[model samples]
Target chain A: MTAVRCVDLCKTYRQGEVDIKALDHVSIEIKEGGFVCLSAPSGGGKTTLLNAIGGLDKPDSGEVYIAGQRIDNLSKGELAELRLRQIGFVFQAFNLIPVLTARENVEFVMQVQGVPAGERQRLAHAILDEVGLAGLEDRRPADMSGGQQQRVAVARAIVSRPALVLADEPTANLDSKTADELMELFRELNDHHSTTFVIATHDKRVMGYAKRLVRMLDGRIVADIKQDAA
Target chain B: MNLVFRLAWRNLWRHPRRTWLTTAAMMFSNTLLVFMISLQFGMYGLMIDNTLQAFTGHLQIQAPGYKDDQKIRQTVADIVPLAESLRAELPSVSIAARGTAFALVSSEERSYGIAVFGVEPAYEPDVSTIPGLVSEGRFLGDIDAPEIIIGAALARNLRAGLGDELTVLGSGRDGSFAAAVVDIVGIFDSGIADVDRSITEIPLGLFQDVFFMDGSGHQIVINAGSIDGVAELQSKVGSLLPAGQDLVVHDWDALQPGLKQAIKADMSSAFLMYGILVILVAFSVLNTQLMSVLERTHEFGIVMSLGLTPGRLGRLVLLETAIMGALGLVLGAVLGGLVTSWFSVNGFAYPGMEELASKFNLPARFFPQVSPLTLLVGPAVVFLFTLLAAVYPALRLHRLQPVEAMRAV
Candidate 1:
């Protein structure tokens, strides 16, 4: 099954009287249980494409589908519901809600999905332990180190076992060892749970963990390559 | 809903100082509103009771035209018997019969035109404060005694003192020439210049004989314990009137038309000031909530991207404000009620209130009424306004673009 797909996506931004094409006629697809990395330099439209796929942003023109469901035409509330039920997202920074602890942040999506408190608590604890944050469940994001905060964000995204996970610069603020460990965790989750992973980054170390690599420049796809697991 | 509430509560304390400052503003305003409103109502109660009990009882049964025109001929016949019958029916009420006429009262050295009232001296104190305010000598005792009690200002004008003979001259109910020589038995200083200068009282029997009233009097005054019960008392008294008698029952409001108007005017002005205070507090809330929303723009975006609807996010903000408002309301009302209750028991007076009250024949100290309505009305209004103030900040959430919002620092 195709876990995610985009067809002829186009988006534009105006920077002080200059039109910048963030995504221009971009299109891609990832199959079920696929691990794909989108590589791009700064201002090269990777984040915009990820946002469009997650239904967090509307394209000036195109179609977005997740698990074979067209999402680009959905309303804001509908998109939120779709994201809550089907997709999980991890941003580069400021990921966890400041007022919530690590466990609570991990349980946020399931709680919104109306999961029973006991079940949510059980799942949140298990995910925190899996992310190597066993004893830091009660710590707020501000009290955690950069690597730990990113781990918490990653735990929150995949804790509910979503079919697809979209991560933008997931290792940008992490040290080298922490980044490698995080990539290994992502790979383990992808292989064990059959959860499709889409990560946007320019880091060669992060791209090495992907089964497929897609390169972009000036909002247009420039290369598509398949490789064995790192 | 529990998670939302928890999130909202936790968010409120993110900046504890701002939350506390905003809550304090609401608390202070609510407390002031409670106290001032209660005090105003209390002062109004005093004003009404003082003015009514001073002379005009809470309700008066008078000849149809007598209230509008104090003509001697327009009198309630057998007033004393009627009042005695009412007193028997309503044991709790105080009843008195009176006859009024404009007469020339002359002392040995001077004379003046004054309104002389013929009162049932024994029952007069029950319905009026004037008899209790006698400053000199004694009130009239003998039912038919040729004696009178004049106000100090009236005595001063007529140059009369206790035991002095005064000549009372007036027209009778039959339009005949009425004249008599009466001795001054008492003098009262009511502190109200108009009443003191213009009013005099004599024994009802003596007045009947001297004025040829023929068993008739002008008014049957009744005091029904409190102003709150006056409406029911008026209805009761109106129904009890002898059939076919051309009499009307006038409540204090009817007898004193200016009183209600004065209370309404004062209330309008006071509420305007209260409205200003509530609005000021609401603006303070607006400032705090707006800053809170602006500061957390990125967090809100992340939450939105996490599948939390904008409507839900807006509701969360409002919930936070509501929690803050509830705190202010409960705390402020408790504090205000405590302060007002103390004053209600001990009485409150401003500087020089005693002297001012003495000059106007009013109570020296005022009590603030601390009923639930007074305690809650102000705080409830403030709570609603604070919620309204949070609306602008909550609406800003709907305008957020999650992609752009996550980009905010």
Candidate 2:
């Protein structure tokens, strides 16, 4: 089964008198448990594609399906519920909620998911530990470094154990060492939990970890390739 | 719900200074409102009590038509015994029988027309403040003494002084010629210009002699403990009046019919001012909440992406406002309550207050009446307005799109 499928997705943006094609008749499919990398240069539609897949953005004309269930026509509330239940997203920067501590950030998704408090806390702590942030559970995002905040965001995204994780430049602000560690963690979650990963990034290092790599230029895919585990 | 409160409370502290400034605005307004309302009520109470004490005496038992027409013949029958019986039946009440007649007073130098009150000297002190207002000589030396107490203004008008023989001429209860020779035994400064300019008092017996009455008086005044108890006591005392004796019972409001309307007008003006103050504070809160939400737009977008619906987010902000309002209310109430309680016991008065108070026959020190109503009304109004103010900001959240909000920069 396809974890995500977008058929003829098209989105447009207007700047001054110019119409910018952010997505143009895009069509793609990623098999269940597939680790895919969507690579594009600045403003080439990687983030836009990730947003569409996560139900954060609606294309001007497109059909989006997650786990083979149509979701492009969902209401804002319905889309939010779908994202809350089945999808987890990690943005490039400004990920963690500044007001929440690391453990609370991780617990937030599960908490909103209506998981029991005890179980939520247990899962949050385990995920924080898995993200190498066990003792820093109470550090707010502002107090944490960029790398630590990214780790917390990653922990938050995976805490509820969603079926799919859509990440947009997740390692953009991290140090090379932290970036590699985060990619390794992503790979571990993908292999062990069969959690499908679709990461949109410009970083070649992050792209190196993908089982399938798709490259886009001017909102059109120019390359589609597959590779062994990093 | 607990999670929402936690998130809301945490969000409040994100901008501690802004939150405190808004909360302080609310608190200060609440405090000022409570104090102002209490003072207004206290002043109203004093005004009513002083007005009633002057001559109205909370309640009066009178003949049916005497109030409308001051006919000396329109008298409550057997007034002395009737007043005595009322005083005995209601121990807490102070009842005095008095007769009033329009008479001509001649003091050799000048003759002036004045309203003369005939009273029982002993019971008059309990039922009226006139007995305590004498600034010269004394109040009706003895009830049966052929003496009179004239107001200073009246004395000034009549050119009469203490120890001077005054002649009073008036028609009697039966329209017969009634006349008396009385010594001015006292001069009272009632402070009220209207009261002082035309009022004089004499013993009830002498009044009867001068008015040609047979143990009957114009009215029996009763001061029943406090103003708050007047209506209940009026009913009880009214029930005790001799059945079918053709007497009317009236409370102070009936005696001075315009007092309630005057108070209502004044209170409406006061609340209008109070309403403005509350709305200003509410706007201050609203501005703070909007700024806070605007600053946290990205954070909200993240939360929304994490599965929190816009409605839940809106509710979160409202909960935040509610928590902030509740906190300010409690703190402000406590602070206002403490100040009001202290002033209520020790009294609050400004310079020249004594002179001002005396002008209206009011107490020198005015005590604030801080009832539950006073305490709750101000803070409750503040709370309600704060929530109302937050509605605009909370509704703004529902319009935020996670995709767009996350890109707010």
Candidate 3:
């Protein structure tokens, strides 16, 4: 099954009297349980494409589908519901809610989904353990290191076992070893749970972990290549 | 809802100093409102009681048109018997019969025109304070005693004193020449210049004989326990009157027309000041909540992107404000109530209050009327205003674009 698809997406932004095309006629498809990496330089439109796919932003003209459900035409509330139920997102920085503990941050989505407290607590603990943050569940984001905070954000993203995960520069603030460990965790989750992964990055180390690599320049796709796992 | 509440409560403490400062403003305003409202009401009660009890009793049964015009012929016939019947029916009330006429009283050296009231000597003290306020000599003794008690100012004007002989001259009810020689038995200094300079009292029987009243009197004054029960007492007195009698029962407010209007005007001005205070506190709340919302733009964006609706986020903001408002209300009311209750028991007096009170026949200290209404009404208004103040901040969430909000630093 095709887990995510975009057809002829176009988006434009105005920067003080100049029109910048963030996305131009971009089209891509990712199959179920696929690990794909979108590689680009700074301001290369990778984050914009990820935002469009997650329904966090709308294209000027396009069709976006998640798990075969068209989402580009959804209302803000409807988009929020879709993201809560079907997709998980991890941003580069300021991910976790500062007021919540690590475990509570991980449980936020399920709690909004009306999960029972006991069940939410159980799932949140399990996800924290899986992310190598078992005993640090009670620490707030401010109290944790950058790597640990990113791990908490990653735990929160996949805690509900969403069918698709969209991550934008998830390892940007991490050290080299932490970035490699995070990529390994993403690969392990993808292989074990059949969860489709779409990561936007420019790092060669991150692109090496993908089964498929798509390259972009200035909002247009320039290359598509398939490779074996790292 | 529990999760929302939990998040809202935790978020309020993110900046503990700001929260406390806002809460303190609300608390201080609420406390001031409670105490001031209570004290104002208490002062009003004292004013009404003092004004009413000084001369005009809580209620009076008078001949129709007699209050507006003091014509001697317009009289309540058999007022003594009527007062006796009313006293029997309302055992808790003080009842007395009286007749009033404008008379020229002449002493050995001088003479002046004064309003002379004929009062039941036995029951006069029960209904009026004038008998108790005698400064010299004694009140009238026998039912038919040809004696009178004059105010100090009136005595000073007539050059009269206790035991002096005075000639009372007035027109009788039958339009005949009324004249008598009466001995002054008492003099009272009521501290009110108008009442003291223009009023005197004589025995009801003597007034009847001198004024040709023929068993008719001008008014039957009744003093209930307090001003609070005046309306009910008036109604009871109205119902008990004879069906054919042309008499009217007037409560203290009815008899003193300017009194109610004066109180209403004072209240309007007081509430205007109170309104300003409440609005000031509301603006403080607005400032705090607005700053809080602006500071957490990115966090709000993250929560919105996580599937929390803008409506829910707005409700969370209001919830935080409500928690803060509730804290102010409870703590302020408790503290205010304590302070007001102490004053209510011990009485409160300001500087020079004794001297000022002595000039008007008023009590030196005032007690605050601390009831539940006085305590809660002010705090409830503050709580509502604070909630209203939070609305603009809450509505700002609906306009947020998650993509843009997440981009905020």
Instruction: List the candidates ranked by lDDT, beginning with the highest.
Output: 1, 3, 2
lDDT of 1 by residue, B307-407 (tens): 98999889989999999999999989998999889999999998989998776456899899889999999999999999999999999999998888877
Q: Whose TM-score is greatest here?
A: 1
TM-score per model over all chains: 0.95, 0.92, 0.92
Provide the lDDT at B408 for model 1.
83
Best by DockQ: 1
- Per residue, candidate 3 scores C-alpha lDDT tens digits across B1-409 of 4666777889999999999999999889988999999998988888777777777888999998989988999999998999999999999989999999998989999889989899999999988889888999998888789999999988888888899999999999999999999999999988888888999999999999999999999999888868877888889999999889889998888898877787788899999999999999999999999999999999889988877878878998999999999999998899899999999999999999988877756788989999999999999999999999999999999999889989888
If the candidates were sorted by their DockQ against the true structure, best first, what order would they fall in? 1, 3, 2
Chain B TM-score for all candidates, comma-separated: 0.96, 0.94, 0.95
Clashing pairs in 1: none
RMSD, model 1, all Cα superposed?
Answer: 2.2
Over A85-188, each residue of candidate 3 has an lDDT whose tens digit, in order, gives: 88888888948988889988988788889999999999999999998998999999999999899999989889999999999988889999999999999999
Pairs clashing in candidate 3?
A: none
lDDT per residue for candidate 2 within B270-305, as digits (tens), equals 999999999999999999989988988988898888
